[model samples]
Target: MRLHRSLLTAAAVSGLLLVTACGSADPAGDGTSGGLNPPPLKAPTALGSPEGQVNLIAWAGYVEDGSNDPKVDWVSGFEKQTGCQVNAKTAATSDEMVALMKTGAYDAVSASGDASLRLIASGDAAPVNTALVPHYADVFAGLKNQEWNSVKGVAYGIPHGRGANLLMYDTAKVTPAPDSWSAVFDGASAHSGKVTAYDSPIYIADAALYLSATKPELGIKNPYALDKKQFDASVALLKAQNEHVGEYWSDYLKEISAFKSGDSAIGTSWQVIANLAKAEGAKVEAVLPKEGATGWSDTWMVSAKAKHPTCAYKWLDWIVSPKANAQVAEYFGEAPANARSCAETAAKDHCATFHASDEEYWKKVRFWTTPIEQCLDGRTDVRCVPYASWVQAWNEIKG
Candidate 1:
């Protein structure tokens, strides 16, 4: 579903109802232009413990019901452990999520990298009280204290799940699956005008990937960290691909539809497409290009004004539990944040299949973090152009 700006405004004002959310100057956000829009987001708060009822904002698929399988739902277990009634509002994209947070009604939200920092910065999210969440100790240390969720030296949230932007192609249509992102970006005759690209500002990262391989002097560490020269290089590359792309997808379901109908044969995708394609009998596979792919981890963050703080923490502890995390991993098509989730998965290859147990994969896969003026290369001197700039650049490149 395309998110209309009006619906987003409604969601924020309506108590986090099935509302769509949006952002404005916040009478508070950094006044800026270009790049990704600066979220009127609040910064993280190491506030006191959670309060009463647990209200959460998340994408629909993150929490599953027994409809798919009896053991899949993470909330029921949460409900049983703590009497706090769990209230969930599902958002379709990070933009929608950032919009909803303005209402200040939710206790926590599960945000992808693109939206996580916005929430942390907007002060909408309450920092993870690791003391309250014992299971936090089980999370991979590497996933914690990342630059996006941390400021100065404090951590804001816990990493939930992660996956890459790989090229999904049908083995039947293209022999020897395209290794480089070229099959999609280059748009060979067979794939010409039949390819798709992710329809978000962050997607420019893919273009940056091509630059990283084809242009080393630009030194683009994270595609989101585009200097003026590097940023312009990526924009030029994407403009070239616009001629061949059949669709620019914002939602996974929409991308699946385009690919399934054969309107698009080559495109960037997440692992879920491979699983969905196999189930739907579409001859498709996803290949992570050797040039490296951009990926992100979802984070579960609580709000300081939470009505049910204890329940919120209990939910956190439960969701990251080995069983709960694995259930989400199997269904979501990626590795879970909690370490023990790797063991209980029914699929033997589940762990390896999704890079669940691969520490090397974690290092190799450039995890997406919200880009800022400062470089993510662990340096204090250089900084990114900012997200608002990327957003404006995306429009120019797409048009």
Candidate 2:
């Protein structure tokens, strides 16, 4: 669920982990503050022959090889095209993804914002040479070189896809059609033990995001950046919601099952989950509440110690190619990274349904990122709570 700070500390002491900036001083003498300092690793200057195989760590549904369904396969095409056979492991959480990347056994990972920074800081991931990824130029300008995927203006990964976390309810049970997140916050008790929430520390940002809109007096400009008073307010709200929570969910199938069984009449969800639940005869409806929502953007990053560096580069290019990007985005229920993918999706109105290029729509969706003591919102005086503290607080609330 949450990353254990002690495990990360042990890894850091062993030189297996080195987060760029968790209030730690910069090692490069750049005098920079609050930015990751990636390990000294050279970006590949030129492309080479494929290494015959590439191993990848990714979220579920990222690297489909037809094993899940007879028709839902993309890895086969990648393997056939690049001569780089694919071996993929699906990780369920950012913490698991980070720990796996540290082993130095995989070539790349489809990292979310929360894990991308840690990967770069720990030397688990290396800067990507855009020249090597021809399709990179077609990526949305907004996703490139953002806070999580780059350090000191150097790009670390290629943007893959993004999606907003929306509120889902059993259409038959939630009367009058709810339009705001308040249904799951202050008014969550209306549903009593049928309200659900995501099961990670990052979900704390969702609470903070709600407070940003509902309680502006707290001055929470960025949900991921909060001072002590703001952090305490969010934690207090979650602790109160704990009484009405039916279950906290991380696995998509678990939530889908709960909704089908009428266990979770109201909760958070992604577009794909709602589609699947509706297909399975569940009377469910999902929407981006008026208060906005928290979401995730994924980056495909190469391992610094990759055994198949050339293949890794090839995979990066292949995955983000217009056709492949469309496939994965449609399957995973997120906006495709390649702008051209909007036209390639089999579903005629796919991009519109996901608001693929609606920049204004994304303004309300606060993407997930690891919180640090330095305060992401740039406050200098008071020490802000970092992700580790969020994890500790989440444990306390659940307990």
Candidate 3:
């Protein structure tokens, strides 16, 4: 589920950015220079004294100031150590984060794949100077310089955390324990009107990934890179699953409550949500389906026009430091970006539970990314549908 609702104006905002970027031409037919490449926004020269206050836009629970749960706080510790008072605003979805970043009111944001590239393209996010973040070197190597967080070897943001979306079921309700995505796709009708799904366009990748295994002829190498035919097949599968959906969920607490109340018997879920559901006395189990699943690796990005650049850099370093990273990772239910945090987790086996460094396990989980007209799978013969199409298709599927 999306942590927040995407702005209804995402398509409009993205379209405007795309058109404006494409219109600028230094015109010697420089294929090497422009179009779709993120602007080379400069990184900070050096860290300076704390500005005393730093505002952040983040997903729910990412930057906790302790109001939710006193024991779950990391922000207060950072503030106390660095002298930068944290003023955080929780964003429900990537689109909402993008819109908020454009306002230039916040110093930093926790951006997902879908919004990170857009922020970089619109010049709303600056290229990060990794040197400024001392702990960045300790971040998991698998998370660094990937397609979503970096452009041509230039880092854009500091990796926050990563996790796969597993299929969660009420153990008492779903018999035989599902190992494949078919339990929620081709076989969703078995739990008709009791099945749920995440409420975001990015979820379309889950359908595409399922099809990559079930329908090899579709040539769906990368779930995010879909040609017209591949896109149609994925959308069709989602439409079919929609027929059995109890409800589409966005918030963690909502899905946890649904599972606890038995309103939803089977659906897509995060590792944290499943843990929370079980803690609330719900008889539930979660597993990564045999066909694998879609996941996300979030990044903590500084605003291009940050009012407190030095404080923003300090905040970035503070969050990824071992102690703080451990606290946030355990709380958020994701693998810590900092490898050093693994030993610091409250649960002795937390790292093992999430397969934090199991390269083989991660090889099967496709991380979320922003789809563009250019196919991410390196295909050029067929035009791939961009994220805008997925957003529009999601609206239709829900209807």
Candidate 4:
């Protein structure tokens, strides 16, 4: 299933969402920017007794407790080992995750890149003390200390897993094979009323990414960081593509059904969905387009207002432990963040199948990120579009 399950409704709460840079300002001062100076907060210096309970807001399939499938229970083991009774709520969207975190009811969240920066900037998520998480030592180097889950070199969360939004099409339907996103964009009219797209504001980045390669004159260095002109162009492209869209889907099952039923001949999809569709006798194939793709690397972040800090920390450590990481990653259909997990998966080639350790493969994937006024690409001249604008634009495009 896809990490985010429900369609995004409105954008975000007005002006509170703003993501800054990945690190401190450059000494040269060449139109670059720095990370946000979050409100005064500090991670716990030492572990305490378990709080006996930990609340979590996670993506579906992330906090499985054997209720869905008897064989897929990672939470049970953690609860037994740490004395932290697991209480998990599955979030449907990044916006919902952010809203849930703000209530201070949950101790932690499995946040995607688009929501991580917003949590960090809003002081809803706390800085993670890696020393408290023993499994942190085994996480892939490529997954650590990135712009989405960190600021100024301080870690904010534990990397959970990663996957790309791929192009999936019926092998029997799409001829000559496909290698680019144009199958859903510029060439979309050819598949009019058959092309599909993810139903969220973040999908706008996919359009921006396509334009980044097709129209270099726009100077779209980063899909998430778009100035006025660039943002308008991307919006325009989507508005045009919307005319041909068969349907916009947020639920993976719906997408899989669409492909199997031939309602959707071509569209953006996840590796998991394609696998399931084909396993069910759908003649489909999924691939990373040559133009690259918008993907997600989820992070397990603790709430700043966590009432069960010790248990939250324990849950963080347990989730990324080799065995648990492997279990969740396999179930969720993504590359595990823990390098040691490669040895734990039931499928001998699970790691290889998902490119778990392939840094070069991931280089072609632009993980989803929050769009803010300050350009994430470090352009300081003009204000870049924020996520709220994307949300508003998305509504109009769909209209």
- In terms of TM-score, the best-performing candidate is 4
Residues 320-357 of candidate 3: C-alpha lDDT, one tens digit per residue: 99999988888778888999999999998999988888
Q: What is the Cα root-mean-square deviation between model 3 and the actual structure?
A: 4.5
How does each model score on lDDT? 0.67, 0.81, 0.82, 0.86
RMSD of 1: 7.1
What lDDT is reached at residue 285 by model 4? 92
Stretches of candidate 4 off by over 4 Å are 1-4, 19-35
User: Model 4, 129-173: lDDT tens per residue?
Assistant: 999999999999878877788776678899999998999998888
Q: TM-score, each model?
A: 0.83, 0.89, 0.90, 0.95
For model 2, residues 1-399, the per-residue Cα lDDT tens digits are 011111111122232232434443222212233545567888999988999999999887888888887688779988998899999998766777788898999999998887787787778889899999999999977677666676666788999988889999998989889999889999998999999998877788889999998999999877887889999999999999999999988778888899999999998988878888998899999998988998888999999999999999999999999988998888878899899999899996989888888888877787777676666665667667877777778789898
Q: Candidate 2 regions off by >4 Å?
A: 1-34
Best by lDDT: 4
> Candidate 2, overall lDDT?
0.81
* Pairs of residues at least 3 apart in sequence or in different chains that clash in candidate 2: none
Predicted structure 3, TM vs. truth:
0.90
What would you estimate as the lDDT of candidate 3? 0.82
Error of 2 at 286 (Å): 1.6
